[model samples]
Target: MRGVLVFDVDGVLVDVTDSYRETIIRTIEHFTSRRVTRDDIQQIKNLGGYNDDWALCKKVIQDFGCHPKYQEIVDHFQRIFLGENSDGLILRERWVARDGLFEQLAKDWRLAIFTGRTRSETRLTLDRFGAQAVFDPLIGNDDVENLKPAPDGLLKICATFPGVEVVYVGDTVDDAKSAGRAGVGFIGVAPQQDSRRAELVELFRQEGARAVVDNINELEQVLK
Candidate 1:
């Protein structure tokens, strides 16, 4: 049986450094009037359990001595990310999939998504890339009771495939923990250009990832 190749959307299949990451920075500044850096965001990501960006943003705002309702943060984040007129930071995202990458991977492994993005967010990118057909059982945040670092999403995919070997490609420490808890193999993505590359690589190694690659384009060789 072909193994399942599961992917985390942000930083794995799509580069969200400018979109989602930027949204977090913008959200924090909007609430706190303090311009935060990606390092601020990465610090929280490194600590894990802040998979929900809204939750992370709220924590950042609180650190700056502002207390906004969770829904307030969520609303502001969506405005910046999705935009009021459909022209938001989300459009700034760059597609990471190279030509024929997913097509080739699909030949040997079934592809699926288990991401922090809502189904609509995932679909927007998939539709832009014309990649809706490439992934099956696209598990989004709303699909599960718990998000990453909880094995819920990975277990859901495994249940779908039924006994197939499974591998998860993800970018953060939470992603590794999610895979580990689900008893699935994991490949960590830490691009060479990322300022936090060294830190992420060490964390993935500490988590016992099967392998760590810079990006999904390199995933083919590791899967071999």
Candidate 2:
């Protein structure tokens, strides 16, 4: 039986928090005319949930009555969220894999990416990182109306690669829930000892995650 390992791109594989934070701040400043602090961004994001990413962002910035349409917001974020310059507005890290990753992972499973990104952006990032070779059949923002914390994308992936054991690895509670919602096993590949790490592990447990490890280094023990 073929086994499949589906992954989330942003946090799990690529550390883009800085870029994302700046993009949100810029988007808000551009449309709302109100400056947002980091705390404010977290509050809005935590409350809005995954499906509301774009819509909530627009709503927060729609105060000037000069708000652009959804596609325009999409265009704006895409243009700003990608790059490798440290002096850049956002702190987006390169999409390099964690150490000893492919050698350990690719041997046992067919890999794929399900990201909350437009196809063009996702493709570009994947291409830039040289990770496209590892992930086949990429699914992005264009593929579905709902993303993580919802299961449609992963289920779609399972359907495409029929009969494979599905293991969806990610770095957040939303990912764990999405995997569970899709009836697949979830693995949390956390990289740091953030305060939220334990909470995320517990959350995944609550959501029925098969394993929650600090990194993919623990995967072999769990998968075996």
Candidate 3:
């Protein structure tokens, strides 16, 4: 039987350093009136439990000593990310997986998505890349009661493919923990140039990750 391969959207299949991460910094500054850098965002991400970018934005805003309404922060984040008619920072996102990589992987493994993005948000990228039909049993933030580190999404995907080996490819500590909790194999993607690369690689090791690659293109070798 073909094993199931589940992937995270941001930093795994898509590079969101300038889209989602940039929105986090921009959103915090918009509310706190103070500049927030990528390093600042990295600090929070390194601490984990921040799979949901909206919640991460709220926490960072509160850390800056501003207590804005959660919904207010979310609205601003959506404005910056999704924009009025999709002309937002989200357009900056670049799919990171190598060309033809997903197609090749799908031949040997059933592909799926378990990402922190809302289902609609995930679909936008899938549709843009013309990969809307590549993944099955897509699970997004809205699909589960709890986010990463809770194993809800991974468990849901696992439930869909009974008795099959399942592996989750992701980039965050929360992702690692979620995979561990779900008793699924985990492969971490942490780019070498990232400021948090070493830290993330180490954390993935601590979580007993099956392998840690600098990018998703290298994942094929590990899967074999």
Candidate 4:
């Protein structure tokens, strides 16, 4: 059987250091009315099971001794991340994969996405990168009750493409756990930035990832 490749959007494919991560820090600060540093956000991310930024923001707010309704937090987050006007959000992100990487992978393996991003957000990013047609069975947060570390998204992708070896490419410990629970191979992509890369690589290695790479472009070599 041909191999199936499942992807995590945020850290593996798109660099979220500026966009989603910034939004999480800003949202916490916005709700608490106090500054939350990127390090604070990284602390939460490092603990794993925080693929959903909305949920992460809520946790940060609650941890800071504040109580706000979930919908209110979501509204504020969407406003700031998606932006209030045509100018768009203050934060920006870029693709971690090399140009035409997905298309090239699609030629040899079935490509799919299992990400914590919402369907709309995933669509917007895919459209932006001209990758809408590359992946199949894109599983977003809305599609699964339990997210990463629960294996819900990975299992769903496996169910969709059965009788094939599935390899999940992601950047976090949760992603490795999900792939492990779902009985799929995991390739960890360490954070692109230098400061976090070594630590993240060690973390993924500790998780028993099939392989770990510093760049998404290196994924091709790992799979081979």
Candidate 5:
């Protein structure tokens, strides 16, 4: 059977260390007027359950004793994130995979995206990278009622391309959990940065990841 490969945008295909991660930290600081570290944001991310960064920002704001209305938080977040020109917050995404990797994969398998980003934001990034045509049935947080750790997005991909063996490639525990819930195979991509790779491998292994690769370049071999 031809395989179906579903990808998570941030941290899987695109490196978010300087983009989404920075936005999360900056958004929280803007509201609370208090500094928050990337590690702090990562802690919440590691805990899973938070599939939306806006919601995550709100939770952090509440934890810091600031209860801004949801709309207020969202507005502030978009201002910092979308910036003056509506270009982007931290436009520093680098591809995790090697060049031509996705194109090569497309030759044999159906490729799609399932991400926590809203459709507009996801489209912006994809367009920025000139990768708008790479995926089919692209799914974002807006496409479903529930996010990661819930099978809604992955289930949608499966239904769209039924009867194929679906494999999800992602970077977070939530990604693994969602794939597990959807009853699909999962491959975990740990950060390529030295010790973090080892740490994430262990984490994904604990989550029952079928295989954990330290970098996206390793995926070609693993899929073989």
Candidate 6:
């Protein structure tokens, strides 16, 4: 009676590309007077890095403590990192919620989000993108101690809407793992050139992913 469609926000929904890393690099530079290269940021993302962005900044602090106003620098970086997004970040023609993505899915499933982003950031992205209206319930990183690759978010979604066919659609291997951990159907949305996606696809299948789509548009056929 309550089927669900859960999504990952960053690449699947937001199309962040390199902005997250770029902003974070800038943030680290602003704080500790050290600027991490794009390659380093990609490494961090690949390594499943977490533990308060400040910790990442701390790593740089050891090298360049030259910044006079470290606290101010940190504050500036925070503002930029978790800072307000531009209109394009929220709603651009190219990234308009996958062009009838939720619309088709919502017809059959109770749509929702299970992203690594904070609820505040999630709301900002969704509302600005005009996507909030499509989903009845939303699950954000703020709701759980752990994120993707952790079952908390998926399990929470399953618990919220019990006795329903659950489908977790996400762009990362972590998404597939989280869905498997939650004992639900995992649909891997493996966007092309998404960095290790082929290996991730194999991992997804090994982890019990039901399907893997190249894009949200492909989800229609894959879900069927």
lDDT of 5 by residue, 92-198 (tens): 77766677988888877888899988888888888888889988889998899987789999999889877889999998889988998999999998766634456
Per-residue accuracy of model 1 over 1-224 as CA lDDT, tens digit each: 37999999998999999999999999999999999888878878989998789989988899889998989999999999999999999899998989999889988999999999899889999999888889998999999998889999999999988879999999999999999999999999998987888898999999989999988999889988
Instruction: For model 1, state the Cα shift of residue 2 in Å.
Output: 2.6
> What TM-score does candidate 3 reach?
0.97
For candidate 3, lDDT tens digit of each residue in 112-201? 999888899899999997889989989998999988899999999888888999999999899999999999999998888888788888
- Candidate 4 off by > 4 Å: 192-194
How far residue 213's Cα lies from its native spot in candidate 5, in Å, is 1.7
Candidate 2 lDDT for residue 54: 65
TM-score of each: 0.98, 0.78, 0.97, 0.91, 0.92, 0.76
Misplaced by over 4 Å in model 5 are 194-199
Model 3, global lDDT: 0.90
Best by lDDT: 1
* Candidate 3 segments whose C-alpha is farther than 4 A from its true place: none
Each model's Cα RMSD = 0.9, 3.8, 1.0, 1.9, 1.8, 4.0
Scanning candidate 4 in windows of ten residues, the lowest lDDT window is: 86-95
lDDT of 1: 0.91
Best by TM-score: 1
What local distance difference test score does each model get? 0.91, 0.71, 0.90, 0.82, 0.83, 0.68
Clashing pairs in 6: none
Cα error, candidate 3, residue 86 (Å): 1.4
Taking all chains together, the TM-score of candidate 1 against the true structure is 0.98
- Counted clashes in each candidate structure: 0, 2, 0, 0, 0, 0
- Which parts of model 1 are misplaced by more than 4 Å? none
What is the model-wide C-alpha lDDT for candidate 2? 0.71
Cα lDDT tens digits for candidate 6, 1-224 = 34788877766766655545455677677655566775564444444433234445555555565534556655665566554655222233135355776777777778878887788867876776777787657888789988667889888878888788888887666677778889999887766766667766776788788888777777778776
